[model samples]
Target: MIQLIASDMDGTLLDADKKLPPQFPALLEELYRRDITLAIASGRSRTALLSLFGDLAEELIFICDNGACVMQPHDAPIFHNLPDQTIRDVLDLCDTMPDTIPVLCGFHHIYFPENADQAVENEIRRFYLDYHKVPYSALYQTKEPILKIALCNMHGTAAYTAPMIQERFGSQYEIPVSGDYWMDLMCKGITKGAAVQDLQKQLGITPAETMTFGDYENDISMMECAEYSYAMANAPEHVQKYAKHIAPANTENGVVRTICEVLGIHMDSLRKSV
Candidate 1:
């Protein structure tokens, strides 16, 4: 019997239009009726996730900034793995590399560059537009510290500069590429898997009682952490390798279908009986 369900926001739970499925909220309601916990784990910032969720915010635990921040809905943050010196160094690097923008993500707020272009705006929209403007210097001066630093390099140069940057910053700073053009730098212990473990412990749930859904490199640890792991059919092969199950694509209501199937909800209208 599953006690918790943790899912990735972007490619697994959200559909092609980047919207949650029409019927999933009801499905989640059903799960909650059964007294199960629901969590949204993503590389997105906590504020962004909350804004997108809007009214539904109260029913979930948010594991944001790729597991760097974790908290209950509409509540003060309970967890953060912020790195002060690393955020400073990453911001300095972005200054040197003018073509790029370093997005500082934390449980408190999202820091943006002075100005951004269409590509950058599109990137921002993808996370539901949850950022505020702050001076680079003031951003680094934060007493709150930083959970993750996202380097937005639409030119796809982060891969090239990333290795050198990691070498310079050493182990405390780690750069992980999620999209083709974007790279995220996080502290050593801050990862999706680590966050899942934290949630599992808090809820008194174990791997056998947890289920997760995801479709990206950042979702890899989540896919590995849960006993009942599922990789969206739309996921890359590398990410799929982490899951024991493969559901249909996001456009096909995979989450709802898979959960309905697992719970034996029998939604014959939504699927062709085999």
Candidate 2:
């Protein structure tokens, strides 16, 4: 029996407009009634997730910042910060790359260099709720720990930026292409998969009892941690290769639809009159 269900946000749970499914509340309630835990895992921050989940925030498990931080409602959060020197290393690397906007993710807020393009700030704010514009060098001085360092390229990630970062820092950091335009870095062992493993131990559930859905490279780790892993039909070729099954597109409410199927809820039968 599935005890835990986890899904990525951007390309798996949320639609292209970054909106959640309309029937999500009802679906979540049903899952809770069945004693199943819902884990929302994403590269987004806890604050951003709370804003997105609203009333449901306290009821779900959050694996945020690409698993650099994990928080369960009413409990202290577990966090992993990139070493100060590592943060500096990423900043230095960003400096050498033109048109690359670096975002220093912290538990409290996301930070951007004062010189960041206005467009970049707009993009980051779309998913990150608490954020600031500060001198990049000052990041090393902040007392708050750093979660992950992200670089955004308006054109695309897979072409140039992702490769450059991987070649330079892949050995020391976990560099994952988060979306079409962003690549994020954290300490080598920090990943959504690792976070899921931690959560499994804490909840006393095994991989067979977990179900996961994802649509991007960053989500591959979490997909690996669940036996019921599903790749969105709209996911990239690489992403689809890692998952165990395929679901409908995110726009079609694929994640929820799959959950309903797993729980034996027939949509067609429900719509029939008595």
Candidate 3:
């Protein structure tokens, strides 16, 4: 019996347009009725996730900032922050990299360099709801800890910025290519898998009782943490290799579809109930 379900937002749960399927609300209600917890695991910030889900957001668990922060509904969030000196070093390094803008993710707001262009700001606003353009030095002075440092490369992080970042900081930090255009840097050992394991222990659930879905490399850790892990059919072959199952593409409402199929919830009944 699956007691928990965690799914990545961007390429797994949300469609290419970043919208949730129409049936998602109904599906969520059904899951809640059955007492199954659905956790949104994403590199997105908490505020961003909440905006996307609206009032429904309060009902789900969140593993935000690629698991640098974790929270259950109505509970104080837990954070894993890089050392202050490390954050300064990362910011300084990002300054020298062309086409890559570093975003300092804090508990309340994400910070961008004051000189970032409008195009990049527009793209970033899609994922981060609350943001400020400030001098990089201001990031180190924030009252809240910096949860993660994300490098945004519109041209594509994997082929460009990611390798450079990996080569420079891979051994010292937990850096993951979170999306086609984004790579995240965090404290070592902070991963979606670790967050999932924490939740499992808290809820008295085991890997066999947990199910997860993801579509990228950053999701691999959590993929390994579930007995019923699924990779979206749209995922790369390398990512698929880590999962136990293959879900339909996100465009096809894969997360909800797979949940219904594996848990025996008829879509017909779900639609009728809606």
lDDT tens digits by residue: candidate 3, 1-274: 9999999999899998999977788899988999999999999988898889998987899999999999888788899877888888877788788789999898888889888888888889878978989876776676677899989989899988988888889998889888888899999999998999999999999999999999999999999999999999999999999999999999998998999999898898777766
- State the C-alpha lDDT per candidate: 0.77, 0.87, 0.90
- Candidate with top lDDT is 3
Candidate 1, superposed: residue stretches over 4 Å from native: 73-75, 128-130, 133-144, 268-274
The RMSD (Cα, Å) of candidate 1 is: 3.4
TM agreement with the true structure for every prediction: 0.87, 0.94, 0.95
**Pairwise lDDT winner, candidates 1 and 3:** 3
Error of 3 at 154 (Å): 1.6
Cα lDDT tens digits, model 1, 3-66, are: 8888887778888788887776666677788998888988888778888878777888888888
How many Å off is the CA of 64 in candidate 2?
0.3
Candidate 2 global TM-score: 0.94
Q: Per lDDT, what order, best first? A: 3, 2, 1
Q: lDDT (0-100) at residue 169 of candidate 3?
A: 90
User: What lDDT is obtained when candidate 3 is compared to the true structure?
Assistant: 0.90
Report the Cα lDDT for residue 250, model 1.
Answer: 82
The runs of at least 3 residues in candidate 3 whose Cα sits more than 4 Å from the true structure, single-residue gaps closed, are none
